[model samples]
Target: MHGKLTPGLDFLSDGGEMGALMRAHDWSTSPLGLPERWPQSLRTVVSLMLTSKFPMFIAWGPELAFLYNDGYRPIFGAKHPHALGLPFRQVWSEIWADIEPLVKKALAGEATYHEDLHLVMERNGYPEDTWYTFSYSPVRDETGGIAGMFCACTETTQEVRSRAALKEEQDRLRELFKQAPSFMAMLSGRDHVFELVNDAYLQLVGHRRDIIGKPVREALPEVEGQGFFELLDRVYATGEPFTGSSVRVGLQRKPGSPVEERVVDLVYQPVTDREGNVRGIFAEGYDVTERVQAEKSLRESEARFRNLADHAPVMVWVTEPDAICTYLSRSWYEFTGQTPETGLGFGWLGAVHPDDRAWSAEVFRDANAKREPFRLEYRLRRADGTYRWAIDAAAPRFGSDGSFLGFVGSVLDIGDRKEVEERLRESEAAFRTVTNATPALVWVSSNDGNIVYLNERWYEFTGQRMDEAVGSGWTAAIHPDDLGRILPYWQRCRETGEIYEGEARYRRHDGEYCWHAFRAVPQTGSDGTIERWFGICVDINERKRWEEHQRLLINELNHRVKNTLAIVQAMAAQSLRQVGDGSRPELQAFQDRLFALARAHDVLTRENWEGAELREIIHEVVEPYLRQSTRHFEIEGPRLRLIPRTALAIAMAIHELATNAAKYGALSVPSGCVVIAWTLVPDATPRLVLRWQEQNGPPVAPPTRRGFGTRLIERSLAQDLGGEVRLTYDLAGVVCVMDVPLSDEGGMLEHQSSH
Candidate 1:
């Protein structure tokens, strides 16, 4: 069978893959018989497929033997090499039910055409969805009778899927346009005619059915004069987008309805073609009427506040949230003499005193950072080149949403009041100095007897810490023996607001018990209520001992009186021999010495000779001179004690100095003044230094000769008291200095160290 075919009968010589496969195939056992016996119509179709670039297939004879061109090989998938010369039904049996009618119509001599036809094919071994645009035409025999079917087809599977995907996308876009929350509309043409609108857009325009195909101005005529129509026209003509916020619009829903005003935020975006020609516009917007109205109301309220602040009395100011000044009241400008250009922002800091600017700025910035209120006092430079104290108080401002806005503040000048407060502090300091120097322990309490203040002497004497001794804590420092009764009496005084005088034993820091006379007086306020209690605890231990000694002295008084009388008789005999008249200088001098001795005895008698306060002895000696002159005198020192022998010597020395001062030194002149001060130097051996300085007196020459007072002050005082005394008489005035050792803890000097 292979050797029988001649070249002229060969049907598979021209086509590529399909023709080659057909030639090499065994056709003797096929239904079409041999290639040479095939009909002329089939041969003609085969000749067309072989030379054509398009894909084509033919079926011929009774069994309709299948044939296709090389361009059709891919359409068969994996069945190409084996499908040659097979019957059409056998070759495509999987889709035979779908294609048999189309093939039969062509064989009956009728033509058919299908575009993008759907088919399920298994040419590659498994079923697949496929499509094609093809035509089935009848092939005639030489006698004009239908013989076979011919098909010219192109697979359109990709185009079918693309159209389906495009349809799905269009459906989604239509849904989005209809169901959108904001107002949206589509316009077409240069006339800006409305083509499509969603539900929101319909409601916004107050139109239900009459808007499509109508121009924007004709559909919503009330918006014609509101510039919205003009805006759409501009976007269409220029192909540029326009956006606006809080745009005013008026709408009338029906022919007879009144127009209503509305505010909207909107945009008109042009839709253009690939060549950049403008088509129409896409409109999108939202209603913003409520927000716009609210902002208007807030602006009105702010105006009212500004007016009030402008006329306020104090210096009022406002600042940004970052503490930059934004506004200042008229009073502030007048006070600082600054213009807006110089006072705005941080420039106002220049009005603050140079020393206080850094501190004031720090405090202000810190409060601003925390968004808190604050108060501060600082000096501000006023217009007159003077600095005045100002109290600046400010509070942070916040919005309704609780966000920090800024600060509103005021300043008040307090220069006069501040001066008064400073003076009060100075007065209190002076009072404290006097109380601290006193030997007696002093305390002050509230009307209810809660201790509020204690002098330095009180702390030193009791060895109590300040923090531990205030209020009720002072009770712990009282001697246990005396507190039992003293507490009851103290309560009585506090209740009745009466003067209290009592005796008690107080414990010293050294753990020694001493008798003290406690006295307290209530000071009343203007309302006749007790303001405070001032109390002093004076040491009276010596007085107590003196009383005890006087009892024993009663028996010895007679004997001592006889000895004193005999010594006085001898002294009188010597005075009578030295001067005949009682007015003589020697007699008067002797009497003055005797009187000085007596005054010393008087001080010792008051102290029971245990000790005498050195200050008291000095006061007694100078009392006469102090009474005769109006000179100012200052006496300052801690309280000190003197033994009987030392007290007598110091008393004599003071009397002689006073006598000389009255005659020729500070006391003799109206302008003269005296300052007597003493201090105790604590050491392994303590020493007390007493200085009496006089000023503003007549010039003195060291004294032409040593007078009796000078001799006593320089020689007798130093020898008798075992101390050193120096008397200087120069141009200014007289100055006397005494240095003596103190033993027994400020009691008396066992020896003197001269300097």
Candidate 2:
């Protein structure tokens, strides 16, 4: 069958597609001529190349004609048929420069070989990158001389690209591992050799960055017997993953340093191939030393707290933020005879007295919901099945992270305290009976200003029932005009916890408004804290009327007194004018003194004869001097209230001082100024010190004899004031000091004469 396919070319027979084409090809135009005329060595080589299943090609004669087998046809791509009879260089013209030298060497009998050599070929319509593992070897002639070259090749483009892509992916993964936040490492083989590690791994291992390429046991010698090595071995042998949390491991972080304790959370995953064989391990984890230590400390603290609570005198309890009881101290169990199973959650409420259980639960739940502290007084069932009052107090608890944890509370037995309180209540009833029998309208108010008690007299006077007059209801009995002002004043005193004294008109049961004197004193506890306001309301309408009548008479008296002084002034002027004698100046001086006294009387009357401000008196006396030029005097003083007698005396003294100053002192000159300043000295005996100093005045000298102005200031003023007065005459000016004692309550320090 082979001989029939091509009679003169056995090498071209049975070669599949390429063989069939070669059999019909017209090789007469080729430099090598027809297949029948070819040399035996060339024919034998072509036969060998065509018979082989591997890819093979041959170049023949000086033209180096290209010939290839069926296995090599795909390598030529679209150029397969046409490339058969072309020159070898022309068939691969795109890579001729790269292959020409190799072709020459093979032809010279050197026989070169290249594996996976790079080449650019135009076998297709366009140029492309191609790779191949091919060899070039000389084909010998019948005489054993080199005739042409032979080549066996395979296109390796896919394989080369696959390898490059795999390397790129590996590099990217390595970079990701290096920059990972947690520690990561790769161990290669069962020995657990550190093949790769990231910076995080270095930090976890302390000062051991040069750990790669070393076995785990050798690199970290201190971790040898710490069970990590055994864990790794187990994982690799069983081809399983191992996980650890808060695992203890000792480490030598610094050179020649003591072994330090450490803890970690880690995973060891076995690395394997397609055969399910364990090849290496991939490790990833976190250093959890600080977290482990904190947990240990927390456990110890809880233990200590439990120990203390067990021995405590009072019952202690703990609850979750949801108000569910979680813990109860030994005292609670011993006192209540309750076991843990019957005491947790809302079960503890069963031990409370039936009357208080509902309200106690409500108070506790409400406080828990709002995360607030609370206090409660309730009866608790004792172990002997008897009830006893208890004071329970608790405050909200929180975690270090500010999370609401729960509540811690304590409960103390207060049965004795309750009995004492009962006795006090009976004593209060007896006291109330006595108050009711009295003629006064007695009442009691809470520290918060709520009326808590009212005797029979109060209800009888106000014509109101207990409910109608208690708390704020009695405010209706107050005259509307006084209600508004008294309510705020009463509330202010309550806030200050001070005594309250106020007058308000009270509407009587018969519908008439009457003045009432209200007085309330704070009733304090043993701790000195106000517990209640004990008060009384007294009827003062008759006294008020009498005071009003007296005030009217005083005003009438003031009017008559002013009229009589005016008549006296008129008479004095008329007598002096009629006399027409040298005594006219003296009479005028006397009239001026009377005028000063009358002005003082007018100020005292305006004040209701109680007192007058020293500031008002000073301003009154200086009114005459300020008529022309107000700049002649500088008067400065604090507001001081003086008694009526003292005010009159001080006013007269100031009048005399100013008169003398105008005639012979600082006020005597236009440019001269007087500093009239007074200050109150708060000493053991508070004193009012008034200073009158003259400046820039004409030279002054002691008087030849004592005159009325001097006499009035030194004798009358001092005697009426019951204080001292100093008058000094210096060449520069005249200075006067008026020193008098003053009461801290703004009254007279001593007896003040009306004169």
TM-score of each: 0.38, 0.49
* Model 2 stretches with alpha carbons more than 4 Å out: 1-203, 207-234, 243-247, 254-257, 263-267, 271-307, 316-386, 391-411, 416-568, 581-591, 626-640, 670-755
* Backbone-clash count (model 1): 0
Best by lDDT: 2
Q: Flag clash pairs in model 2.
A: none
Per residue, candidate 1 scores C-alpha lDDT tens digits across 1-755 of: 34554665676566666666676678889987767777777777888887787888888778888888887888988988678878899899998999999999998888999999999999887999999999999988888887788888999999999999899999998999898877899999978898999888887767555889998767777776677777787888888899998888888755677987888899899999999999889999887676687678878977877788888889989999878999998888999999899999998899999999999999999999999999999998888889999999999988755889999999999999899999999999998999998999999999888899999987888888999888888887777877888888888878888687788877778988788888889999999999999999999999978877784684366347446855885688587876686556666666667767766776776666667888898887777666865756788887777887767777888788776777788888888888889998787777778898888988877877788777777665566556688888868988999887666533463332111
lDDT of 1: 0.82
Count of clashing residue pairs in every prediction = 0, 0
List RMSD in Å for every model shown: 32.9, 19.7
- Model 1: weakest 10-residue lDDT segment is 746-755
Q: What's model 2's overall lDDT? A: 0.85
- Compose the digit string of candidate 2's lDDT tens values, residues 254-357: 76888888888999999999998999999999887876777789789889989999999999999987788999999999999888999988889999999999
lDDT of each: 0.82, 0.85
